[model samples]
Target: MTTISQTAGYTDLQTALKVRARNPALDRLRCFLTLVVLLHHSVIAYTYFGHTDPKSWIGFDAIILSTDSFFMATFFFLSGLFIWPSLAHKEPWIFLRDRLLRLGLPLAIAALTIIPIAYYAIALRRAPHISFADFWWTTVTVGPWPSGPVWFISVLLAFDLAASTLHRLSPKLVDPINRLSLRGYERPAVFFVFMLIVTAIVYIPARVYFGASRWFEFGPLSLQSSRVLLYPVYFFIGAGVGAANFDRGLLSADGRLAKSNWAWIIAAMIPYCLLWVLIYMKREILGNPVWLPDWYEIIYGLLFAAFSAAILFAILAYFLRFKRLGSSMLDPMQAAAYGMFLVHDPIVLWLQYWLFDVDMPAIAKALIVFVLTVLLSWGATAALLKIPGATRVL
Candidate 1:
């Protein structure tokens, strides 16, 4: 009996290790991406191009540009990874209920309260005498309700409903995508090319017509017009890839994606450089035209799509390659990452508001904001999770 107990203990330990081995890396990646989101917002007011605040820096412009180019779309891709397995296991109503609780609740809370408070900083700067209550009420009732980063949650819920319908219509709809994913094990570039083409085709026309800087903002629903179709494409592709035999697909440790990490790095750099060239052309050659020609938008849009795809490929490849390594800093922070994302925006904005009067360079101010935002966001998330049943949704 003692010997059998020892065998059972060993079996449990092995089971635990096997479970953690595959999941930790992806969890770490999500945490890191959340931090990136914080950093992106912290630096935005200081970017030379935006110049909303006193401090301005060209480096911040580059940071914001690069980040905006890929982060949201990549987020959709990451969010898609577990959808297939989730749908396969849960009843449709059960899944819908969970999504509503997890996604809808947060979005509603953020849009109604947190987002208003965050944007209140901007409003105060614009009109110092306006009371918070008045601003909040008018904002909520009248017009221009900014969703901020919580926009992703609302959009994701929509995608989940759409994907649910597709699954119900034909469970085998993703079979071809799974086959495409199988090819990625040896030739990951095939998947990369397919993603690039689809996004470019879907995105370029919308970008050219609507132009960049325009968002369909009405109440809590808002998204970049160009990315509406593009984001869904990436999400659906991710679902298809994860639909079957996930471990043997592109994310597999032994796949060409892991082996070609350096190649993907090079791939990411080329389009990034191309984007800068186009920027130079816009500033110098086009004389910074307010109304850009369709040809320029088409070319720039195509390059943007390529850059976006390559960077995602580069990030995924690098992560896959190092997934077998020991634990990372992101491991300890993983639990709070989602909460951090939900809360960080307001923290960063408030900090910026307080610091606006201080004498400091853009880089220094941005650094301080990023550091404080991270610590405060993490602490807030931890504290919130201690509430009875808060952890279930948060």
Candidate 2:
């Protein structure tokens, strides 16, 4: 028979293990990305290059360009970082059930309610008297259902399932990448180059084939054609890094990757500038043709992939380096971040709709939208978490 002291020791050990499983740096990084998502949508309507609002600014164009280039791919990579470990610990059925609750439930709910409400703001711009009843009915029953940002949730769930299946089939498949991650602790640039090459291989041909504006869509499911494979490449690379010896791998706090943050920033800037150069060539030199040439697409795609990979390393390095610097504004919002992401689109779109005629500068309107969206969405998530058993899904 076990003594009470022994049982208590066992319980404490289990608690410590659970706490150790959670990474503080990654948590804060995730929170920061959630805020980025809000800011991206809030200012997108005001970008001078793709202005949807009465007021527009070139600065917002730069902001959107960087965020659009890497944020979603980074999100998928961050998500993949824990997949192998998760599948190792949980029973397959248990893993699936939890993923369904966390991802699938939010996806279904958001697609049916939040997404329609959000897009309706745009619909009203086109047709002022369109009733919500008519719009919702047509959106679900007929055609043109958009998933909004919740498409990330649906796609992430699919990737998780595929990863689990792959893991069960051949546990050692990601061993090569894991080995590279271990080596990255000493020479981070090698890992960086590897990711750049892989992403370019998967993304360039697709960009040339799809021409950058096409999306594969069905009801509430949609993915950008050029990026459909790029995301999974990041996903699996992340999985490989976390597959084994995670604490000793590329992202280790003491690793060269974290120590060399400035280098990654420079790496990111070069390709980003080249990207703008390509944009200039398209508009001024190439006359903004309906279809850009294959040579142009190939060059643009390679630069985009390089920028994406470099920026990801830069961000992870920054977070890992300063991870021990104690509490942050981001800490308080970390738990609420996912809920905020799910709920913010409607709040932001509605705010933009209301502010359309406010007679303000582009920056001022964007500022107002961003601040209010953060506050309202954070408050809404807090309230939603108060409902009985809501925390499980949220």
Local error of candidate 1 at residue 237 (angstroms): 0.7
TM-score of 2: 0.94
Q: Can you give the TM-score per candidate against the true fold?
A: 0.93, 0.94
Report residue 205 deviation for candidate 1 (angstroms): 1.0
- Per-model lDDT: 0.79, 0.83
Write candidate 1's Cα lDDT for 67-153 as tens digits: 888877777777776677777777999879877887788889988899899989989999999998998999999957877788777
Write the residue-wise lDDT of candidate 2 on 1-394 in tens digits. 0000001111111121231475678777887888888899899989866587899988988988898898888887877777777778778998798888877888899999999999999899999999999999999999699878877776778888998899899988899999999999999999999999999999999999998888888899888889889988988998899788988989899898889889999999999999999998998999999899999999999999999999999999998966677777778986677788889988988999999988999999999999999999999999999999887776
Best-fitting candidate, measured by lDDT?
A: 2
The candidate scoring highest on TM-score is 2
* Global CA lDDT computed for model 2: 0.83
Q: Give per-candidate clash totals.
A: 0, 0
